[model samples]
Target: MTGRDHDHVTRVMRTVSCDASAARSRLAASWQRSFAHHRLDPAAAPPQDRDTTRLAEQEEMLGRLLHVASPRLDELFSTIGQSGHGVFMTDARGLILRARQRAADEADFIRSGLVAGGDWSEEAQGTNGIGTCLAEKRPLIIHRDQHYLARNIAMSCIDAPVFDHEGTLIAALDVSSPRAESDGFNQLIGAMVSGIASKIEIDLFRDIHSDRQIVLVGDDRAGTALLAVDRDGLVVGATRSARIGCGLARQGALRPVPLRDVLGETSEGLSGAEKAALTRALARANGNVSAAARALGIGRATLYRRMKRLGISGAD
Candidate 1:
């Protein structure tokens, strides 16, 4: 290794060993995990190329999510591609399934192990944008030396975790720049990545539960709070934000909780109560406006007006 490489490695080792306050900071804690749990050397060789068969399997596993994220990836790349940034999407295991980079910048990112099929899990690559975000299950920005590896210290990476319809973390969306940039710029890119990730989750949830009644549980501040309700008014699926905001289960299959139970009858005031009641009635009546109106002791026209006022649509 060169003198500068040795210096970088020395600093990383010292930080991991002597930094008692490392536990308090997310970056330091990740460095600690790299040193202690993963036992990764800051100056270790680049990660090995993944097997093609295994990568294909992972791609297949992420089929639906990949379909939903394709356009968003293109949209993100369109904004950042000319600025020396590369967009990458990795599966739950941190294997890059898809990547987008300008042809001129491709070699640099490839040399930096940012190509498709690269293993970037925290265990494999230390505290990187993709690995650490997946490890923590949250959005993050790892700029320059924030990366645990000396080789990766030149790039800035922003990442956000993508959860499946059941609120299980299924992938990570990332944008990386080899060119040096300010933290402010990195934060901006981070926000864009997070927004795209949320959009992908929302799209995937809707696609998977297309037949079910989708209910927006909270405002944008709640971060895509969406619940998929079945014909019987049972919540069959929820996005990650909805799961967290509504106190639904975070892992595995949801227990088919009632829409009313999840939303709470009085939590959102009269409007919420009315919306839920109309939704339940419509669901029970199989989207028949006349039948649902009769069940609710209201005329069809009145029910239609109420649905329109509540921003509900698609019922017969």
Candidate 2:
């Protein structure tokens, strides 16, 4: 190795060998994991290209998510592509499935193993952005030298985890730049990447639960506060944030709980609630009384009687 490369690896080893409590920062903790848990060598050569067949299989498994996340990936690239940034999306395993980079900067990213089919899992690449974010299940920025590997110290990586409708982590969105940048600039880019990831999650959730009533429960800055309610006003699904924040089921089939019960409401509000539910169902059905009635688990005649009692009109 070159003198500079050797020095970088030496520093990484020293940091990782320090006392556990002394390395309390996230970067330090990741370094510890890289050295102890993963047993990675910071000075090791870059990973080999994954086989085409394996990549195709991973792509097929994530086909639905790729379709939902394509536009958002384009949007993110448009925002940062010209600034020497490469946008990447990885499956839950940290295998990059798709990437968008300017033609001029493509070779550099490829050499650094930032292209599609590259495995950036924490176990594979140590304390890098895409892998570490997926490992921790949160948004993060691995700025330049924060990367455990000396070969990756020149690139800044920002990433965020993408969860599905049921709040299970499904993928990660990342933006990486080889150009030197200020910490403030990296923070701004990190937020943008995180926002795009959240948008992808929201789109995926809506696509999966299109037939249900989607309710925004709280601040959605993280885009996890979504609940899917059925026509009978039962919450059938919840996003990760909603599940944790609202105390709902975390896994498997969610128990059919009344929306009002989940929202901590009383029976005194039943009339108003029923009217609102009917209106929403009708709107979703495009004023088709039979369809809306079916969605609400009621007969067409019963729905018409309730609509009349509630003074709702505009139905055929």
Candidate 3:
């Protein structure tokens, strides 16, 4: 190893073996855990790939997620896989269920233990990209020698967590390569993975709430967030971005809020946005005509007239 690389790993091992509360970042904490809690050998070889004799078994295991995310997976790979890097999708437990690499780098990727069915969870692989990202519940790029194992120093990886229909984290998407340019991995790859993860979440949210009144919140020219409303116009569920867009609490999903309580403006229930906004506003104000009207910035008379036309009931 080069002098700098050796020194870097040595420093990490020392921190990992001691108290690391001063480490504010997740990556630093992970590095500490790799050697301290896990007692993993920092000089160990990279994770080993398992035989794919039962490849169908793994595919069946990830059937629901694969079904929901397959199209976008192809699109994601088509967009990003053609480059020197590769993409891997893993189940919640970090078993690699799918991998896509360009023709030029497939051999190297397979040799690096990125084949389907390989386990990359923290419990198994220490502080590499997929394992650490899954453990920390965040997106990250583990570049070059940042990997805990000496053998993994040649590679860099970016990973993003993917949530299931119930909003449970169920998978991760990893993009990486030994051949990747450091600047590009830092500048663009993380965002690309995050956007793909968000799209999967949006699709999953819609699929789960197909019968409900689902609306995407945000500016039209910009992107949107996914929100699910009930018959009474209560916001029942939202994607992470949607929650942020509507100013909902970050810790737990926000409590059931009326649509109008959150949206700032309203139209006369003619357009989709207007209707969704009015419905939520009326629900939030608890059917009090004047109150709901005032919240919506419309006159009580106008609210009453619109309610009748729109067939909204229980307005006092």
Candidate 4:
């Protein structure tokens, strides 16, 4: 390397090391781990492609993610293609499920094995857009020199997460393109990618909870988050937004909890939705209060008192 280029690399490395020590940013943590744990050399060209899943395995991976993502991929590709960006979808593990780019852009991606069946997890690629986004569980942009590998330093990547009906991070949607010195368009690209990811997540939620009442949750801070409330007014399922905005995230994946808890609303105020839920449960249980109460996710005694207040009459 020229003396000037070598000095710049040394400066960036020292800065990253200090950033890693301070733990001030997710990007720093990822870079530290890449260098410390994965033994990647930021100054060197990227390592060779890691082992990819076989064709048959790729089919299985596609089968799981495609239905939920298929309806929107074409439209997203059209938009991104028009803007000269290549888009890719990856499963939770960062295995590429699908990718699209203009013919010119497509060639290099394929040559680099950034195609379907490729694994781009953090451990494999070291601080890439798709890998780092998954590691952080939030959408982000990884631009140019931010990439751990020298080979990827010419590309900028934008990625967003996709959650299932239960609020599990099931997919990552990403866009990649050549980075210019002063493109000044990462935010616009991030917004577009985020919108597409949100649509895919909501589509999956609606399909999974077609029989339930889906309510919009966040507005003030979260913008638009969706949740499904049962007849008892208990939260049954939630979109990624609702989970984040309403603070309904469980320890693991999606778990149903009472709406009163999630919304912080008074029990009396929830009577309408709760009563309707009880009515449906009672009808389904053939007027059995015991079964209805159980279905309502409440104690029989609690259900009885609630029914009394609501003037709901049903046989025990």
For model 3, where is the 10-residue window of minimal lDDT? 265-274
TM-score winner among the candidates?
2
Candidate 2, superposed: residue stretches over 4 Å from native: 21-23, 221-224, 267-316
lDDT of 4 by residue, 16-95 (tens): 66844537766677888887877877666554554454535755745745777876878878876866678899888788
lDDT (Cα, tens digit) per residue for candidate 3, span 1-316: 6676677678677667666442676766887777767777776665485846545676886676687788877877888776778888888777888888888888898788888878887777778889998888789888887787776778888899987644567789898888647666555978888788877777777887888888878873324377788877778887766666777764355588877767865544546655566777878888788898898898999988877776677557
Q: Can you give the lDDT of residue 88 in candidate 2? A: 96
How high is each candidate's TM-score?
0.84, 0.85, 0.73, 0.76
lDDT of each: 0.88, 0.88, 0.76, 0.76
Clashing pairs in 2: none
lDDT of 2 by residue, 195-256 (tens): 89888988888898999989999676665588999867899988877888889876556888
Error of 4 at 229 (Å): 2.8
lDDT per residue as tens, model 1, 83-174: 99999999988899999999999999889888888999989989999999999999999998888988888889999999888888899999
Q: In model 1, what lDDT does residue 180 have?
A: 94
Could you arrange the candidates by TM-score from highest to lowest?
2, 1, 4, 3
User: Model 3: how far is 30 from its true place, Å?
Assistant: 0.5
